[model samples]
Target: MTAARPGSREPGDQEQPGGGAGAAGAPRVPAPRGGRAPGPAAPGPGTVPAVRRGTAPRQRTGRERTGGRPGAAPGPEGDGRLTHQELMSLLGVWALDACSVQEAACVEAHLNDCARCADEALRLRDAVTLLGPPRSLDLDPQLRHGVLESALARRPAVRPVPGWAAPYDAEAARLDALLHDINADEWDIPVRVRWFAGEERAGRSLTVAQVLDHLVAMDGLLARAVGLPDPLGADAPADPLERTETRWRLVTAAGGDSGPARLVAARAWEEWREQSRELVRTAARRGGRTGEEMLPVSVCDPGIFPGLGAAAGPRIPLSDAYLNRAFACWTHAGDIADAVDYPYEAPLGAHLRLLVDLTARRLPGSIAGRRRAGLATTRARLTTAGAPGRTVHLEIEGAGGGDYWIPLDSPTAAVTRVAARDAVAQVALADVEFCRLAAGRQSPAEAAVAGQGDQAAISDVLSALTALSRL
Candidate 1:
């Protein structure tokens, strides 16, 4: 959907619901120490037992015999009582500290039915187990000592660029070049109609025209932040006839047809292209780092900007800005490409993967503690389509002897295999969807289910990711 134009009235700014950077009542949890826990063992033969709260494990008719190993606790007995799944969740927290193989198996069986529990179990496993091998690196001791001493000696000053800030200059240039290549004839339509009128995909609704508007506004803001004269009129008269009148002066500078809104939109497009090119040139000459490195970078609360303002922050690291902006551009470009019936061509997926890995490795201790419990490994088949004709035999293993095989390269379609652990939670959604959810625009449940093959696993991953994001 098209974003409201700059300077337009917005909804009352409210903190995003649920906890994260800008959420209300978010808790401060400790960082996780290592990697994730192991997978769960597979349930062998017959119908897997269905466990629910208030149902006694023993008293139910047609219940399978609990062939639990020796020294195993008796399964719950009675209606409306804790079922195998509930008990596993309870034990999942403690699995890292100590849990028997049989206990893990029982929990895995329960997880097959409960998505939430499965997700939790996977998180706990990551926290307690998945420690990567320690790396040994050689460094100059004197340099290290000097850097530390310098850090301790003085507080670093946050400085603004002497001229216009040049954050994202390269990207801006690329965008300008791309816009120039598109037919000038096509620029004369409403951005929404041009980009998203008939698109039917999750991320494709925001059209290129909408994206242009956003970029123009953003560039203006960035320029203002660095003490540059606003290239587009900062105080132009609002045009009553414009679709979005807040930035009317700037929009009007770009000529369009007199009667039809389409003509206005086309003129706006041309203006945006020219202004964007100028901004990129100005940005390139300015000696500034990425937006993230700009200390005290001001951002409004997402409550003010609908989907855009939730994760605002000041002087965020350059890496973070690059990640956020890259994701935004890439995902939206994917949408535009889809709308235009073109192949998607973006390289941000690798960067996204890196972000996930970093976030996973640095989860807080409280969240990590949860993952440590009852961790096991299992093998399952994985498949992906990006790679051509290559099949990878993935070994999935976890706490309860959970093992399966996956064709890592051809995982476009979900394939069912014998798995006690919810594979989807452990691998896919947990690492990515959680961050997006915390940033707003998605429900925890929705993120959990995104691209998930195993609902139970997705739930577990969601819980862990939610917990981690809060931390």
Candidate 2:
């Protein structure tokens, strides 16, 4: 559960994977359209779906006129600061260009000062825009332009932060986009975890809200472990699983079978998500290294850190903790997708590569812990097949494709890219399937794997992957 910081190595450490930035495949948003993103456009035909997968919507639109009353009073009873409820109400009105001149000015002014509100407004606008314009009425182009211009005027250009953890940020963004427009009723649909962990017959289940609550609970553990604030706050339980269960129960209770309560739960999930994103951002600022760093946490649950008592959990690398969070997020995203009946697949790009690399880097330690003799003497070259450009490379095609080499017992065991031309064992599968296997969501028997040379070595590697997760 501990890890070396990005670009750092401990004794007997190998080169780090993802040491080099891969293809810049993630879409390039205009650089703030002269330091501000253009105002969001209405969703084109077939744009607005109730809920979509984790793909981020394009925020680009053609240039438009900027027109809105400036320095106007918000409303009859308004002070400068708009309450949360008021701001929420105005978001849709503003997006649809239905706001009065004073109201539009007030919203724009508020957005200029509040980044969070600005983000929400943009998202809301995108949702409305996705619904597309009504075919019944030929709306004036100037009206739409005015709304977009006002919205754009207040938007400051945002630059992506560069760090080793950027991949994690990208993954988090996709999950957030997926959760944005879900209907309140969908939150109560029970999710079956049968496909994962072979517990189908156990009848284990969680509703959409419960799944999110579980995520917040689990994320809080890693956050506290690495000195980040616990999203669940000070009054939560001391045990990790107990705290998660307790929180889930409270979330369900707070969701008092009322429509508003479910909406509140959804908002709460968004808050938890922001906290999780903040952790990634903070870590990136620290050069993306957080292993074995000591930090005080109110609850030190032994369940979160196996083999470590409460007192011993403080001194832990946050990177390891973050990886743990990433794994949980990736695995549970699949669960959420299943709950909603959406086709789910993890990207084979940076985030998955990091997960694979982390597992590969820890293979030695895993073997040593589970089978002591196996670690002391086992020396094998592990490579991946099925990727183009490299003869012995791991390939994950589709959205986030990349070629990687798994260094089993090499001096540079941590390196993500492969330098070795030949490996004693090469196993190839799609990245999503590989992730499932590594996460223990799929047993080796269930995984479709092609292996060549050193069948015994292949078994060892697969065994290590199957047992990699402590959760």
Candidate 3:
């Protein structure tokens, strides 16, 4: 007879003289180490005593054990064997090498016998191949620098962000990154948005997801102007205040206005990202054209703040509107940062300068608007942009900043550069602080660091800056 191979069992190795045989002539086999027994088939639990012969089992937690037993199959209760559903659920962990040794043995044995499980196991193992290997959390420090350098290289005629739209693009991208990184639970965290409305400190409370809902409604206006669909449907109110309310109501009805509003946030987030991308693409199509149109989109209504005329708000250029969108994005991003206790930097120098310039240019209108509502000292001394007029030497200090002699009376007046000494008063401010003031995040009382000249003009200009802020 041919010699039995190494580790092979002899005929009747696991068979007792009495019974316990599997199939015709083949023994119910698992010849255990150094055993000599002729005993009855086990009838109950522990009757077939647990024999652990391998290395000591690792410290076990829930549903964990070491090696599988030899010859000891499950009793009537199928004790120690996992359910089909349980085994299926373990496929991922098993693929990842996370399953305990006993569980691995169980999974392997079951996969061989059950075609369905075997198919799933094959697929899972194939997927695990794509996982490669475990990696360390520590990343190369220059990875971000390399990636950004790659993405920022200007591909002319392709995704070219116009100079005016860069701030909006950057801020939108920053906010999108923040949203992508946050967990579902963070969506429910409360955020309070403050702005100067009706000539007073006005504020409202909303969850983070609700905040995104608000953003979608507001940004949808720019989307509409650019011929993109609004997140809040076509019939949505043109007025921002009403639009915001309408958005919140819809979110509430959808069962996403409250605790852990992950669905709402996710929907709004998708819309925001898509809309932002579309906007950038549309701007790219403009090819440096200002697309200057009378966008009556009231970011801050002349009626909202008291003294402004019954006349509609500024007929801001579309380029200016893009800048406004960027400003709002940056401001709200800061709100999100506060909610999550994250630190975020302000816009870059060029972008910040443009933002500040826009806000400064609009200040004259805000002051005039506030005056009509009796908020500022009405100055009838109209200054012409062509000829010399009452100009504040608005010294914006820091990057993206330049000296601006903004006319106090009218938005139409030409801003002729005047000698520094010829200025009525010089209001010097850190560039970012001025932006915060315009965003209504800071009060006029604390917004200015040093003001020398007409305190009244300074106060009026400062207060009017906040008037630029809206819901």
Candidate 4:
């Protein structure tokens, strides 16, 4: 840990010297115990930087300071100031060059204003630098070939992400990058997947390979719906769930011999990626499918989990279908990361904003059906949820985000601008958290909703959003 610079000690830690009147008749107090000499008087301006005296550096909040938790209100300084904890938490990541642009900026800004933080960041950076590169070791020629094969096996056919789908695409690409160096043995590491059913956490567990197999199965449906070739052979079942389970069995069984199994998984994954690339390219060629080109695209029955698109679900534009596919790819990538114990970062800003926008548009109607079936006074329940007010302010922060006023009374809420004061509830969520909540992968109880104003109205909106999708 970095030591504080001279004069940066807390007031309590500074020696308060006391001394009897000296021969010159100057009054002074004696020095405090601990054999410390009297501290020097504050330096004149320009001689030394001013020490910011006051409260003990704010106690660390939670495990580490973040740029504020997803929904916690920002300090009066807004998001510019990094708390001590925030700076500390960011130090290691920044040193490793693994931090996002926003996070890096926060640390840099905090370092400028805080000598303690700056010193600490320097110490950490130096330690990292001293570690240097790993000692070189001769590798077996066969081992090198296997590693290269594994890395290439994970590479999907690359393509430029369309403007609206950039975040989703970038996130998927990140997951692909994560698999590059994983050991063969780590492929089977399993992770528990959970979702809130009312208040209980429930969902299946999956291994890295199994999760990729599932993506291969699910995205195959998206590919077909968007008029791309089926990644799996024609023998697969028509029902997506049945097909998924059936293909999962085949893919997993084929890999019974680990070497052969990896090849099987790799082939399926590559085909899916290639088809995904084609799907996007096709959509782009059609001028991105605006207006009339944006038509209802029902691919399969709604009963099947991650059926990809619903037969009876509302008709969405063609661009949304691609975005939805991207969401699926990126989300499962998160699952793979959890299994392998790698840190996963989702794309932020515009890409994530698009998904948030999609969820906001669907919120009202998703609740309307349940409202009619469950409540005797449907109008009252709807009003309590603030649907009558017609709009809720969603403050989705970090990456692919903006202040959105989502309409609560209709199934399709066009992107309308509404003032902060006019919203029924000002709900705040991080980009990934909101996407997970909207996708039905996370329930409200499982997700924290940071908000101001009508608590009931916020709860109402969240409850309606709890299970918007089955996958």
RMSD of every candidate to native, in Å, equals: 30.4, 18.6, 19.8, 21.4
Off by over 4 Å in 4: 1-161, 196-200, 232-240, 250-264, 290-292, 295-297, 300-313, 373-390, 409-422, 439-443, 446-448
Candidate 2 lDDT tens digits, 1-471: 222223422211211111112234311111011121233343223211121222233342312223322434333354434465776677676665556545555555555445466566657655764575333222232343356458757883243333344545555655665576456566676776533222221235766656677777777766665567776776666666687778766765876335653675576577668877887767756652443355443333332332233324434345545655666676776777667765555543555666655554454444434343344224443543322121223443433334445434432234323433555556677667767765666777887887786676567666655655433
Error of 4 at 44 (Å): 57
Q: What's the best-to-worst order under TM-score?
A: 3, 4, 2, 1
Candidate 4 residue 385 C-alpha distance from true site, Å? 18
lDDT of 3 at 99: 65
Residue range with the least summed lDDT across 10 consecutive positions in model 2: 27-36
Model 2 lDDT, full chain set = 0.51
State TM-scores per candidate: 0.34, 0.51, 0.64, 0.56
What number of backbone clashes does candidate 2 have, counting pairs of residues 3 or more apart or in separate chains?
A: 14
Q: What are the Cα lDDT values of the candidates?
A: 0.35, 0.51, 0.64, 0.53
Clash counts per candidate, in order, are 72, 14, 6, 13
Work out how many backbone clashes candidate 1 has.
72
Candidate 3: count of backbone clashes, pairs at least 3 residues apart or interchain: 6
Q: Which candidate leads the pack in lDDT?
A: 3
Worst 10 residues of 3 by lDDT: 1-10
